[model samples]
Target: MESIFHEKQEGSLCAQHCLNNLLQGEYFTPVDLSSIAHQLDEEERMRMAEGGMGSEEYRTFLQVISNALSVWGLELILFNSREYQSLMINPINEKAFICNYKEHWFTIRKLGQQWFNLNSLLTGPELISDTYLALFLAQLQQEGYSIFVIRGNLPECDAEQILGIMKVQQQQRPKLIGEDEAQSSGQGSVLEAGPGVVEGVVDEDEEELRKALALSRQGMEVEDEEADLRRAIQLSMQGKALLGKQP
Candidate 1:
């Protein structure tokens, strides 16, 4: 697992990190996912409009990741889907898994004969033994993660090739980057998914959406500051602000 590809936690782009890690490269970016999600959103919006209805869900999340990944001939099957469950009692013939809990996304992929947890939350990839794999998947299920089994050929990598040639022994297991601090603070750490504060995309609609979010946040901050100042002036006029005695 020494050559394991991992992307550390960066902003709320875990979905981006997860997909890229699963593919073992920088195959995706936040803008890339956003454009795909926006396309999906547009399709859903049009579909709803055809029925004289409006959309509810944002739908600018992993649904876009799934769509984008499909270009490489990768198929993601829900672990809880009846189709997969009926076919196998445990995960078999799987290359990788995309796990989501809350809005955070991560990957677990089998490189060569061993599986590795390529979670961005973790400092690095954690080695997973074959015997412990089933238990780990069950634990994730119990912890409310939606697991998607990835099927189809994955891009070849140094780790996969090196491991395929000869397996490496793990001397230590990797831990979440902020495991101790999060536990002490009584917080559950998560890197949110979806279109976020990211760079512009080539897609016109996607760029427009990202610009809207940025402008809206900026406008809100300006308005909030103006409102606060107005309130302060009003309070001084009413003799409520006696500290500076400017009134």
Candidate 2:
């Protein structure tokens, strides 16, 4: 006898089986659930909600998306946290995007709420408080683009790991090629003495000081212009005292 599953519906039976296995230790694969109906049907609702699913984290997630998602006629398939950000399907394009929480409006999509909630759990509900998702959402919303949410079928990630991804994703765009080339050209000269280093010789002020001190030597043998040299040293020192070290 042919099973009722084949004749009656395409996805419902497989989804039920997948959901059952998911509640057990068996992992849910998209391939396994592909032919199944959306598992968010009301019968799977749990009464023994224990941890974060019912906690403030979930509440904050709700508060954020409450304006954009609805609680009606939708089921959330709870999974462990993963590395990716979660998303709600766009109503127009059917693509997924990071969601925005407003006060009281909801979308026409069934999976949108669950997707937001799942992403909230994975990325931390506080992702709503961040500017990156907000800005991205604003851009998408303005552009009429849709975004898909990544449903986590994976394990929990640490804060450091999650934040590192966020930081890289949030970095500013790099310099343009023209600007980069210009900057390189500006700095392309050979490394030379800067303000502090004397070019090709010892510092003039230090040289003058050495000459003045040397001219004061009692046993000097130079006869030509030793007095002139002494006077020149005095003049140089006086100039340095007035003008300070020059390049």
Candidate 3:
């Protein structure tokens, strides 16, 4: 994974610069901060210039980038601070990451098992140890600072296979139902459902299966929305030259 540092730009465009570096490659084109800024409403752009982007604006920007990248079969996943463990454990090949530290944003890239910090505000890329990164995340959590993990170029996997893996993992762990749901199901004392059979087992199994199906349908709906957004962006880019030459 090649680490692309952010380019120096005016105003509070750190997030934009970090995203541009993250998406620069064959599968995804580099993002232009100026073009994005121009597209924003006057008030939103002014907010960015005055005090940096808020959470909602940053999320919308990420969605735009994600929509563009989806054309080439790439996906971006944003994990909140609560999901730091999942972000650290998952290894997506040749991906870029943007993380927040001390209210400032920075970029990071992973090559094999090693991580490199490519903070444009700094002098150069610095090799970061996994242990150190974990400790830093813990400290951030303790201080109640907002931390985010933006991962690009997720690996493609078969939907069925992914679901199978999820099912297996869920089965291995104990399931916690809400107090009301448990009472209604007449399984109030049950902390977890064992592999063995129990009373009203068929009904319980049917309910769980229905919930899984609903979740699967929701996932398909999201995929459809992403595909539609990708097509719209592709059409918009057709024959419309980008401002300035490609970086």
Candidate 4:
């Protein structure tokens, strides 16, 4: 049967490249899935029922990817059709397996059922963004933009640099920059739904101030409210360090 994704060039290329990389023993660990799985252990799974990883849907999905990587190769395109479908190119057997998604999911379990490690070679940014868009239901409000999730540990200064490289490669076409007037007149921008904040909300300064105000009730005998102000500034500076920002 003709796959629904047969005509999609990027999808095919991505699948092929992924499979080829896997054959060369070049595969990246899937961090997002790993994170999701940690909280879905058997005890937690039974508690949550449908939402947790214990659910049939989640387990099946995880297994399918794992098994495909183990046997055929890691490079795969999991396509959604009226029925779930998978096209996995096996590097060892030099064959393609067209299987139902559910079956593929079952197959991965036959291999080690542990979570995919995160600290291992991580997935590239483009794929990461694709995962974010799919999982988060981020809408692209404009013409040609994408979104991806970054680890909480990623430094804010480096996020843009990493994301920029990924975006450029994912979109091989030349970038076009035009005046605001162009957009107002006819140019349209593609605005993708953000991957949500990677780091916590920058409330260090505010939190510091709150703490300082609370400390005032400690009866430290501040010379005056002005002394309290100075203490607040100091506390705020300390909080700024947590955010990796200069005060």
Model 4: per-residue Cα lDDT over 75-122, one tens digit each: 333333222223342222221222221111101100011111110111
lDDT (CA) for every model shown? Answer: 0.61, 0.27, 0.40, 0.26
The sequence of per-residue lDDT tens digits that candidate 1 reaches over residues 179-216 is 34422433232222233243523344333333333322
Write the residue-wise lDDT of candidate 2 on 11-74 in tens digits.
Answer: 2232222222222223334344332323323233121112223554435433323221222222
Q: Name the lDDT of candidate 1.
A: 0.61
Q: Residue 218 in model 3: shift from native, Å? A: 50
TM-score of 3: 0.42
For model 3, how does the per-residue alpha-carbon lDDT over 77-132 read when each residue is reduced to its tens digit?
Answer: 54443455554664343355655432244456553355555544433344545544
Residue pairs with backbone overlap in model 3: none
Positional deviation of residue 174's Cα in model 2 after best superposition, in angstroms: 11
TM-score of each: 0.64, 0.19, 0.42, 0.19
Top-scoring candidate (TM-score) = 1
Candidate order by lDDT, highest to lowest? Answer: 1, 3, 2, 4
Clashes of each: 0, 12, 0, 11
Identify the runs in model 1 with alpha carbons over 4 angstroms from their true place. 39-60, 179-247
Better of 1 and 4 by lDDT: 1
Tell me, what's the RMSD of every candidate? 17.9, 30.7, 20.4, 21.5
